[model samples]
Target: MNVCIEDCTPRSASVFSRSNLRLESTLQELSLYDFQVDLDQVGMVLAKMFETNPTIPGVILNHDSQFIGMISRRRFLEHLSRPYGRELFLPRSIRALYKLSQVELLILPGDTLIVDAARLAIMRSPEQIYEPIIVQISETDYRLLDTQQLLIFQSFIHQLATELLQEQTQSQLMQTEKLASLGQMVAGVAHEIRNPVGCIVGNTHCLTQYYEDIMQLINAYEQELITPRPSIEELKEDIDWEFLKNDGLQMLKSIQVSSEQLKHLVNSLRTFSHMENKQRRETDIHECLDSTLIILKNRLKVGIDVIKSYGNLPKFLGYSGLLSQVFMNLLANAIDALEETANHSHNTAKIWISTHVADSCPSQLRSLIIPPKNNPEYPQNTESSEDPLTPNSQYIVIRITDNGPGIPKEIQNRIFDNFFTTKSAEKGTGLGLAISHQIIYEKHGGCLHLLSTPGIGTEFEIVLPLI
Candidate 1:
């Protein structure tokens, strides 16, 4: 009889039943019996089988149509070469050679996942690693498989997964670069616009003074005119002098107020986009918080009560602008959460900000320094600094709290993950909290954490090491 083994097409119904057998496979759909071979007899018959396939590593040995243990080729040959080995074991029952089996045959279910089987294969010794794994299709039926083949399939899948991740990372990097360029442009425009606006404000003030002097002289001239002149009366009626003078003063005052407001907005924009290198120096946190509040004053005017309980704070060595951004994002989010909650419920929205300098960090801060291994919500530090032997470090603690609907427990762990947000796309770009976390943790070696109770409130704590 002639025999051939080639890849099977998708339409093939039974590749192994005929002499001309073929197979097709993908990583997830690998054939279980890739290394399988059958045995009809043993002794001289098994020896002839070994001579015919000397290079084949091992086999899923069967005896009289019954599944048996795995045998290593080298060990079997060594046992056979022993003195009187052929007379003692050959042609006798092959069951007597069961003691020569080197590897414990692992019988897994036919439907067992290839990944899971690969893990089992790794547990075996080096000598038995190449042995065929036996997959049991039924109580009386079994199929042999190659462990190395499964591992190769797993490697191919991982390669594809890594490529997909690289593509996503590149896209995010491009978006970040665009935002950085835009911020620089905005900062430059705000700085340039401030100069011309300041000149306009000064000229407007001078014009207002000149108008006042002319008005006083005209009033004096009218009072000095003792004879009532019809021509003077006609001139006053034609000019509507009373209304013109009053409206003119009002317009000047409006211009003054508007120019001052414009200057304030420009200053806020400049502060928010300050892109100076992150510098560690003695800087007041309170001033930064106040500047952020000015930027957000318009939003807070809508029924959000802000209460500040500031303790005597010592200036610390840290990045002032980045910390200001952190305060801004947190306060802005609090405002949004409060507004959403207020729309549904009739409760008053409240935000409380408190800060103080401390000799030692708070318990919340300590947890971040040395996170508990069991709590999956808290991130584990790559390195810890809570050691008692290290020099004592002072700390700055800032707490921001809001009375609004709190975040749910299930997803609070994901708040610091990049590109994760609960707000609409137009309202939030999903980078606020993630960027804040990076600024506090990676840039300044600080800690940021939060506590939330549903239907009650949420509080975020920022702790920074002070020098």
Candidate 2:
């Protein structure tokens, strides 16, 4: 049925006062109907309803006047063309039509914000389906609004949109806090893992040298035993020596390699976990880039090349460790993406990392004016300059670019969402970008965002304020 905004009545003074008052009210009147049809008759009923009234968007089905399920106009036509629909006629019961009515029944409290309901509807509805029906319930009796429901539904939808945006913003903040905590944990673990790994490497190297010397002695003994006049005593000693040398050497090498790998892992963990101390100090962006490259070098695939376009830049006051980690993750992901694309071809993969100072940087006078109690990292100082050329106005911009399959438009919106990933479980935790976003935004007072084309590639630009 066609719903119009003008016919619906506002329930309260607050209803008309809201910025998106119309959308808020629209959500209130959009209720589901408990209209049930047999499993066999669903297709016919749906087709007949829509054919009779092409404007009908959707309807809810009920069994024995009890809420059961609902169907949309678009889905009804699609169902009729399916194999299941061809086989069924006036089906004896609607029980078999469960597959046809794929719509999910959502129950919302009357007091719930209309914005939230609309978000749920948008998120859950299939690509080509009608907007979800909002079922308003009050004990046993319920009435479905027709054309009159449109205005109220529209108002509710607008309110819901505003609320959804706010929720998304809050979600981003929460994710940032979580990632900061995680980085702290990783840093601690990396610090702990590093010491033990160093010890293991040192010990293994010493043991390997000792084993090599023993092997040389065993070789000499074997040579004597194999001589024309072989001594039985020499043979016995040589036999045990050979076994000891071979096993000991192998074990030492294994330990050495394992220790090295553990060290690498620790380094990665340390980079990822460490938080930037807010105290703004002059820091070299090039050094951070170099450290990140060193850690990720081994992870890069053969034939993949990294190009650095670092400009002669002044050191800006900022957290170095956190920024290094951000670069590491972004660069690493770029390398991985290129490697993934290179898997099927012989093409060489390349990643570009660049850094420079922003020309028209804004002064941090406003930021500096705030008392130290407001920000532990950089306390307010009246001496700080308010001009663009002053140190306070200087800022750094870093860009990481990759030539891989670009992000799809559909999935790009949620790329920074927690647990959202295009990679398989083993390849990614999906937290890297999300964490990166937090680090750049919250920790460094920077911005991180993507620029891409479907087949061209993706570029992430990061902008940070220089103290």
Candidate 3:
């Protein structure tokens, strides 16, 4: 039977022989009667067809041989007992049946590349029925491949499937990385918003208290002056108009102070949130650091000293707002760590910040360095460079070190990961280092990493390229 089937295989000669055979070879064959049959009848026809010609696994079901839908013997049997099988088998039309089958099918030309044809076959998944057959169609002819061509076609289809699966896996990994970065950004924004909100709430509370006290004083004056009594001199003595004026003036001053505090809180929020625009200019690293220090000076704890070790650094193109954020996180972290240590003993806490010119070498920075790419996150360089540094050369190295208990070894590796925090949930959002990492890596094509010892202290270093 195998030999006979091999001898009867559709070869080039038989494929191109008579006009009818050529037409069959070129066009996908269909039978209207088979498509009109009930599920049982269709199954019988499929079984008989497969029994007679084992290689022919699928058939085109049409009303008049004009392509309507495809039926696969293997798929029909596999889904025969499934929950949706009864509904699928009762499809009223060939198109309905094809939709129920969930199989893909497409006809191909005789000269189509094996690779391309295989991709379409896998995408269509016409093979489980009987190694999906591609019918070659021409204006007046059609052809089906012989056994040799069928084997080659099947091999190519499998290869395409493997390649597609690999590509999907890699795409998923990239998406995961992007999502992780986004999570960090969300947390950082939340943390940065908390301080301004707290300030607003506290000032409003103080204003409410002052208003209550003024209302009480006014009520007392009204009771003394407008009470049901006929003592005009007593009322005049109780009024104390001069004292009321002075007290009223003081209350107004208090309200003004509260209002100003609320305004300052709002301004800080606007400044931090609108940093994207402020950082777009070619900014000096020295100036950015100094400005951040000035703004955060009041927040520093008593006896906490700051030391600057700025070197001859060139102006680099950066977003001042983002750079300020980086400085703020680092400075805040340093202060927090120092304060925690100072609680143990009265050793004066110190934070050291330094910026210096550096050579463009990956070895100089421990983290993976990505040079700035053109995107919404980082500004593209449009201005012609007149400086000695190449567009990708001359990086600024900013190191922030503090004298405090260094990070634990186990958590150091995950310091920059999203939502990884060592501090209490209320104290830290675990996004500070993560955002700093993204700003340095994604936005600036820079690097942020830690150098620390558990007992001594921790240092965070950032490197940004100057163009």
Candidate 4:
């Protein structure tokens, strides 16, 4: 046997009242099935009703008590003013004036919430959004809801949602700015420390050579079987000359190695953070990729393989530092994808970087690049370029691909959207692809595109014009 359990706890009187109030609120409470005319009525019937009841904006219709359609006062006026329309239609029946092009009457049950009625009304066509929604009260009774009141209700909700989204965006930007400031501080400190570390490395090298020369002289003197003076012997024993000779050299070598490593790290940090220059210059983009790869070497050494297919191309004019940051972001993300792939299989994870030149049209390229959402802070460039990318123009396209779980098609259009991420909160800030998109399209006047298949892989293509 099944036993049923029910909640017997008492609820507050105010809560019960609120629930009762919500149940009683519906479209049926608005009005009744009046202000209607018959389809057989003369066309002048609508004009006469409008004159008699000037407050009513529209009238519904019925044929043998079957709902047919509705006509608004505004439309009736326009029809009457048309040349020869009054003479042609005013004396005719309502069926003669009715046209098939009119918007279909939207119907809803009387039990529908006002909010739901408003939502259904706005979902209609551009012309129909302002038309009254028919609320059915009974089998043969109905009511017309004013679209103006419904729209006003929706406008308030829309305004509230917009304000909330604005607040969220503002918070995201504040976090990004804090991170940016921290990165700048770190870069400044690294730059200041590099010079002193270089000096220490150079001095250690000299000391290592000097110590080696002293050891050589001592060995030569000892090989001749010349007895050291008592004072010298005591000094050697106190200093543990034999241990010092081996360990002292090892210490200097360790220091030198560590110093070199530190310098490389400092250089990598500088490369990743050095996007301050906004000027375009003639520089090798391959070198930028190489530097980025060097910085990511530690992460790539475990199970990842990077394959580069470089092509001979001219030095394109662009911001080297900004381009380097783009490469760094792409390569880093590729490595992350490969690492994720490695966790599931023993297969060798790989990333492919290739470059080539091709012909492209600016108009066609513009369609591929997603325009930025309306952001008042960063206004978009509305003017067309004088030197547009004609079909004859040569474009250098750089492709970065990774053999990993690809991005889903649903989110392909949003990969470059600001503050959008597939990664966890601790792993990403969601600005890498957004910044890269801006650097390529807004700054370099290039295009960024992505192609992906879920089971296959993901590829990003960056196209920059040669001219």
Instruction: Spell out the clash pairs found in candidate 4.
Output: none
Scored by lDDT, the top model is: 4
- Candidate 2 lDDT (Cα, whole model)? 0.62
User: What are the per-residue Cα lDDT tens digits for candidate 4 across 1-467?
Assistant: 11111211222223333223332356665443257788788888778777866655577777877877777666777788889887866688877777722567888999887667787888888977777778788887656666875555445445655775787689768976885786688679779988988888798888888988988997898888677789988988999988888998899889888888777777767766665555777867787777778778889898788999999878988877678878878888888787777878666788999987776655655555554565543334423453334467888888899988888889987888777889998878788888888888777877677888996788888888877
The number of the candidate with the highest TM-score is 1
In model 1, the worst 10-residue window by lDDT is 1-10
> Looking at candidate 1, what is the lDDT of residue 219?
83
Poorest stretch of ten by lDDT in candidate 2: 1-10
| Candidate 3 global TM-score | 0.40
- Model 3 lDDT per residue over 311-362, tens place: 9987777776677778888998888888887879666788999888877645
**Candidate 2 Cα misplacement greater than 4 A, ranges:** 1-151, 162-181, 209-229, 232-258, 277-316, 332-346, 354-397, 407-438, 441-454, 463-467
Clash tally for model 3: 10
Give me the runs in candidate 3 sitting further than 4 Å from their true place. Answer: 1-273, 277-279, 362-364, 367-392
Q: Rank the candidates by TM-score, best first.
A: 1, 4, 2, 3
Better of 1 and 4 by lDDT: 4
Better of 3 and 4 by TM-score: 4
Q: Which parts of model 4 have CA positions greater than 4 angstroms off?
A: 1-103, 106-130, 134-146, 211-219, 226-254, 275-278, 311-316, 355-396
lDDT of 2 by residue, 1-467 (tens): 21122222323333444554543353444343333343345445555655655544555555555555556655666665777664572243444555655655555654555556555555654662244454566654332333223334545556666797687568667866886777787788789878888988898898889878877886787688665444666765878955765787788898899888777667756654556565755667787777677677677746778888998788766777777877877887887778778876555677888888776444442332212122233323534442122444556778898888777887776776655688897887676777776767666665566777887888988877665
- Give all TM-scores, in the order shown: 0.65, 0.47, 0.40, 0.64
Minimum summed lDDT over a 10-residue window in model 3 is located at 29-38
